[model samples]
Target: MANNQENTSEKKKSEKKSEKKADKKQPNKIAKWFKDLRIEFKKVVWPSKKTVINNTSVVLAVVAGAAILVGLLDTGFLALMRLIYQ
Candidate 1:
């Protein structure tokens, strides 16, 4: 009927308006996102291959030293505990 057609027409108009508004905002949103990404990427510190290798070696050495220390402590504690209990 005429009333149904009028309602649909109004709905379509409102939808078109909303779509246009969104279209207008899209560029600004995308521009800001890309700008932020660029700034963050610029602030990143890139390590050289040598630096990376040296850091990795230092970490591994520290981990091995700590492991050996903990193992020795565990063994010594067990021996002391056994002596005390006996």
Candidate 2:
């Protein structure tokens, strides 16, 4: 029927219009995302230089302690293995 054809044609036209609108807004969406990211970055409270240095030194001390403990365990295991094989 003619009415059915007209309805289908209208639906297709509306869909095409929506697709075009979405395409046009794509760049705006990206720009809005970057703007939001900048705003959030401004809200962050960064650590002071002295605080950063203190934390870094603590981390290095812990890592060094762990490495020495592991090395001692490895040496003990090697001594045990040599005794067993001898």
TM-score between candidate 2 and the true structure: 0.92
lDDT score at residue 41, model 1, on the 0-100 scale: 97
Error of 1 at 51 (Å): 0.1
Clashing pairs in 1: none
Off by over 4 Å in 1: 1-31
- The clash count of every prediction, one per candidate, is 0, 0
1-86: candidate 1 lDDT, tens digit per residue: 99999999999999999999999999999999999999999999999999999999999999999999999999999999999999
Worst 10 residues of 1 by lDDT: 39-48
What is the alpha-carbon lDDT of model 1 when measured against the actual structure?
A: 0.99
Every model: Cα RMSD to truth: 4.6, 1.0
- Give each model a TM-score: 0.60, 0.92
